[model samples]
Target: LNAAPGWGTRLVAGAVVVTFMASYALFRDWERFGPLLLRHPTLLALDTLFGALLLVSAGPGSTLAYVSVCTPFLAGLIYGWRAAAVFASLQGLVLLLVHATLDNPHTGPAEALLLPGLCVVAGAAGSSLRQLMLRFTEATRALTEMRARLAVTEAVSAERARLAREMHDSVAKTLHGVALAADGLTRSAAAPDIDAARVRQQSGLVARSARRAAAESRELLADLRRESDPGHGTDVLAELAARTRDFHARTGLTATFRPTGGPAVPPVPPAVARQLLTIAAEAMENAHRHAGATRVEVLAGVHGGLLRISVHDDGRGLPPGTDLEQLRRTGHFGLIGMVERAASVGARIRVGRGTRTHGTEVRVDLPLAALTATTREA
Candidate 1:
C-alpha cells in the first residue's frame, strides 16, 4: 500500500510482515539432533511441523519446550480463539505423551513444562517492529494526502488572488467613471435647453443601472473569495466537537458527535461549512425544543466523495406523512430552512426516522461537486 496504495498490495505487505515476525520463533538448536530426527523420516517431518506451529504459540521464556505450542497460537491468531484453543489442547496432549513415553535424560516433568515457559521475547520485538512499520506507512499516506491538499490550496489561492486584484481594478474603474458621469450630469443639468436636459438625465440613469449591475457581479465574486471568518476558519471536526459539547451543556441533553472516513479530511469552504454547521445546530435545537428529545447524535464526514451529515434525536418523531410539502402545512420551517441551506449549497437533504431511537433524523448529503464555486453557481 505504501507503494501502489492498493488493497492487493496492502494484503501482500501485511502477509510479508507477519511472516517476517513469525520467523523469529524458528531459531532452535536444530543442528544438535539432526541425525536422530533425520534417521526417522516421520520424526523429522514431525519436527518440521512442530517448528512451523512454534510461530503461533506464546512461550514464557524458552523456545524448545513451547515449540509445539506454535500451531495452536497460530491457529488462534488466524482462525480465532476457539481454533487456537483446540489446537493447543491437541498439542499439549501430544507433548505430554511424548515426554512420558521417552526414557531419555530430557524426560523430566520440568522438561515437559518448557512450552509453557518459552520466553518468545523475540516475538515481542517482532510485534513492536510490525507496529512501527504500520505506523510509518500510515504517516506516509497522510503526508501524501496533505501534499495534494496543499497543492490544491496553493492553486486556489493564486486564482482567488488574481480575481480579487482584477475586481479591485475593473470595478474600481467602473465606479470611478460612474461617479464622474453623475457629477458632470448634475452640474450640466442646467442644460441651457429642455431636450438636452432630458436626454442627459435618461442617458445618466441608464449608465447608473449598467454600473450597478457590474458592481453586483463584482460583489458576488468577492463573496466567493472572501477571507475566512473567525470560528468557521478552524477544523470542521473540532467545530462539531465543540458544538456537541455546547449543545449538551446548554440544553442539558445528551449529545454525541463523531467523524467517519478518516482522522483528517480536506478543508471545506468557509461559507458552505458555516451553512452546514448552522443547519446542524438548527436541527439539534429543534429536536430538543420541539421533539422533546433527550439525546442527540450527529455524524459528519466525507464518504465516497460525498459529504454526509446527519443529526438524529431520540425523542418524539414527526408524523409519517411529514415531508417537504407536508412541512409547509405544519409551519415548521426548521426542516425547510435545512432543505434551503442544503439546496443553496447544491446539496440534498433527507429526513427520516432516527436509527438510534424512534425519533427524527435529519440527514444532509452533498455531492463533492455541489461544494465547488462552479456548482454553487449552477
Candidate 2:
C-alpha cells in the first residue's frame, strides 16, 4: 500500500530535486526535449525512469550521476525501504548496461557500483526518519491522554473537598448546637428543686434546636441530590425569591426579595448557580440565627457587566475589625463557607455594615462574561 509521506519528507525531497536540476543544468547543455521531460506531469509519472535515463546520459564517472540518489530516497520516504531497494537495483542495472556499452577509460566496474551503493544508503536513512516521526507522534498522543486523566482526578478531588466543607458549616454545626441544648435540658430536669418555668423554657429550647437541626440536614441532603439533576430550567432569581419566602414562613422573619436595575438576570452554569444559592442561604441563615434581624431583604441585579447579589438585614452588624480571616480564626465558618462558595465560581464576596449603618450586608459580585462562558460550556 502507498502511504502519504510527512511534510518533512516532502521538504527534503524538494530540496534534493532542486539541487539535482541545478547540477544537471550547470554540468550539461539542455536540449529542446529537456523542457518536456521537466514538465510537472512527466516528472511525477516517470520519476524513476527519468533518473535512470539521466544517469545513462551523464555516465558513471560524471558528478551529475550522483544526483540520481534522490529517486531511491523519495521512494523509501513514500513506500518504505523495500521499494527503495528495488528502485536502487533498477538504477544499478541501467548503469551497468551504460558502462558496458561506453567502456570509458576513467570508469571501472567498482566506480559504477558505487553510485547504487550510495542510493541504498540514502534510502535506508529516509525509512529510519519516517519511523522516528511515527514513534514521536505516538508519544505525544499518550502524554495528552495522561494529562486529561490527571485533570479529571483533580476536579473530582476539589468537588469532594467542597462537599466536606458544606457539611461542616451547616448540618454538623446545627446538630452540635442541638446536642448542647438537649444536655442542658437533661441537667435542669434532674434538679430536685426544679423551677417549672425554667424547666419548661429549657424543654422548648431543646425542641426548637432539634427541629432546626433536622431542617438543616434535609436542606443539605437536597443540595447533594440536586448536584446530579440537570433539569434546573428555572431562573436563579426566581428560585432565590422562593427561598426568601420559605425562610420567612419557617422562621417568622420578615425576609423579602427585590429585583433591581433590570427585570432578568443572565443564565449561569448549574455549578455556579448552586454556589450562588448556597451563599445566599448562608447569608440569610446568619442574619436569622446570629444577627437577630426582624427585617431581611435580598437584592439581585445586573450592573455594568457584573451580576450582584446582596442580602441586607436591619440587625447588629459585624463586630469592629471583624473580617473573613478573623471569623475563620474564631470558629465562625458560615461566612467563611460563603466566601469559599463565591470563590469556587470565580465571584467576589464582601460582608460589611449595611446602607443603614446599623445592620449587616453580605454581597457577591460575579462577572457577566463568566456567566456567559459557563452557560456555553454547559
Candidate 3:
C-alpha cells in the first residue's frame, strides 16, 4: 500500500539496488558462471538452494548474491523497518556461514561490513518514506472533511437568507396592509354610518394582530441565527431582567423584572431559561400592545424544585372562558405562542387575573426534573 503511490521512492530504491549489483559485479567476478563452483561446489549448491527459499531468506537472487543486502533495503521500502531488520539479520547470518565454510574464511572484515552499512541506509530511507505517506493521508482526510463542512455551512446560509427575503416580501407586506386598514378604520370611525365603538374595537384588533405577527417574525429570525450555537451558563433571572429592560426600551412600556424566591435556586438550564424568557416577553407584549397596560411585572425564581416565572400586567384581564387553542383562529397568537413556549420546556402555563390588581397574570412553572429530562431528549 505504501509503495504503490510513491513513484519517486520506488525509482530511488530500484536505482540503489542496481548500483549495488553493479558494484558486486566489479569486485566479486559475478560475470563468471559461479566463482565458488570450481573450488567450493557444495557452497554453490547451498547458495542456490537457499536463494529459492519460501520461508527463510539466506541470500538474494543467484545473479546478485554479493549485493544481497539490497534485498533487505527493498523490503524496508515495501514493508517498513521491521521487515528490513528481519532480512538484514538473516543476510548477516548467511554471510557468516558462507565465509566460514570457504577456503579463505579470514578475508578482511571491512569488505564484509560494507553490506550491513548499506542495509542500514536503505532501512532508514524506507522508514522516512512510510512516515511521509502517513502524513499525506492524514492531511488529505482533514482537508476533505473541512471542505464538506464549509459547503454545508454555505448552503445553510444561502437558504436562510432566501427564506428571510421571501417572508419579508409577503408576510411583512400583509402586516403593513393590516396597519393601513386599521388607520383607515380609525379615520372613518366617527362617521354617522360607522359605529364608533365597533370601529375602535376592530381597529385595535387589526393593529394588535399586525404587531404580534411582526414580533413573531423578528423572534423567528433571531432563533434562526442562534439555532446551531451551543448553550452556556447564564443566570436566568438576571437575563430576564435584562430582557425586561430591553423590552421597555423598545416598546416604551413600563416593564420591571424581580426575582421572587431566594438565591438558593439552582441555575436554570439554558434551554428552559430561553423558553421561559420568550413566554414572558410575549405575555408582557400582549398586555402593553393589546390590554393597554402601562405596567408589566416579570418574576423568575425557584419554588418546590421548579423554576417559577410569572408575568403580570395592570390591564383588563383575559376574557371569561378564554381558550388558548382557539386564539389562533381569531388571529391573536401571542397568548398561544406563550403557552407553546412554556410547554416546549415541559412547563405548565396559566392565564388569569392578578391577585393584587384587576389585570392579567401569566404564570409558567417548570419542574427541575421535567426540564432536565426535556433538555436531555433535545
Candidate 4:
C-alpha cells in the first residue's frame, strides 16, 4: 500500500473500488447484505480484514468467494505486481484451507483452482493500470517544466532587446555626433587658411562630444550594474532643454525648446519623463543626420487633460511610404524604440508633417489619468 497517496492516486483507487462494488451487487445474491454493502461501499473496500472474513465464511463454491480476488487487485494498485502475487497466493491458501475444513463434496478440483487463477489475473491487470497512471503523471510534470523554461527564455530575449534599444538611442547617437565633430576638426586642420579661433572652437566641440559619449556609456553601465530605473528624480523639461542646446552646439544647427500654453511643462513620473526625453532626442538626431534641416524646434505643453511633446524640423519631410515595417526592413529601430517607449507608459505617438506643413514632426500624447494610474501601479 502507498505510505501516503496523492489526491489523484486516491481518486483512482476510489473509482476502482466503486466499480468493483457495483459489479458485486449486480452479479451476487447478497439478499439482505446486498443493500448494506451497496449503501456503504467504502466500509467494504477499506476494511480488508473484514472482507477476508466474509470470504472465509462464504466457502469455496460460494459466489462470494470471487470477492476475495479484489484483495490482490487492490494490493497490485498500491504496492505493484510482487505484492499482488503474494496476496493472491495467501487468498488461494485460505480458500484451500476452507475447502478441507468444510468437506463440501460439490467443490471439486476445477472449482478450487479457477478462483485462484482469476485472483492472479486481476492482480496483473491492476499492476498494468498502475504503470499507465505513473507514466501519465511523469509526462504531466515534464510538460509543466518545459513551459517554465520557455517562459524564462522569452524573458531573457526581451531584456536583451531592451538593452539594444538603449545603446542605439543614447551611446550610439552621441558617438555618431562625436565622429562628425572629429571629421570637421580634421578638415579645418588641413585647410591652408585655417582661422586660429575657429580651429580652437572645433577642437573644443570634438572634445565635448567625446566626453558626453563617454559619460553616456558609463551611465548605461551603471544602470545595468544597479538594476534600477535611471530616470528617477530627473527634471523632464530641463533635460530636454539641455539636450536641445547640446544638439545645436554639436551640429551648429538652430535648435530651440519652447513651452506652449504655459510657462512650465506639467510634472510627470520620472520614468515617463525620461522616455519622452529620449524620444525627442532621437527625433532631433534623425533631423540632423537624414533631413538636412537647418532649424529644429521642440515643443511641450499640457492641454485638455493630455500631455503633448512634439519635435519639428525645417528639413525635407519623411519620404513617401516610410513606415515602421519599411524602417525595420532597412535595419532602422529608432522609431520602433520610440513607439515601444511610448506604449510602455500608455502614450500614443504620431509621426508626420510639422505644424507648418514642412519638414517632419514626431509627437507623443499621453492622458493625465493614465499617467496617474501608472504612477500608482509603480
Q: What is the Cα-based lDDT of residue 293 in candidate 4?
A: 96
lDDT of 2 at 318: 85
Ranking by lDDT: 4, 2, 3, 1
* Clashes (N, CA, C under 3 Å) per candidate: 16, 0, 0, 0
19-130: candidate 1 lDDT, tens digit per residue = 5464554335446544543355454335435543332232222333454455454444334444444555556655555455445674566767555333233233334455
In candidate 3, which residue pairs clash?
A: none
Instruction: State, as a TM-score between 0 and 1, how close model 4 is to the true structure.
Output: 0.40
Each prediction's RMSD to truth: 17.3, 17.6, 24.0, 19.8
Off by more than 4 A, model 1: 1-234, 354-357, 370-378
Instruction: Evaluate model 4: give its lDDT.
Output: 0.72
TM match of model 1 to true structure: 0.39
TM-scores, all candidates, are: 0.39, 0.41, 0.38, 0.40
Q: Write down the TM-score for model 3.
A: 0.38
* Best candidate according to lDDT: 4
Local error of candidate 1 at residue 63 (angstroms) = 70
TM-score of 2: 0.41
Model 2 is weakest, by summed lDDT over 10 consecutive residues, at 148-157
Q: Give the higher-TM-score candidate: 3 or 4.
A: 4
Which has the higher lDDT value, candidate number 2 or candidate number 3? 2
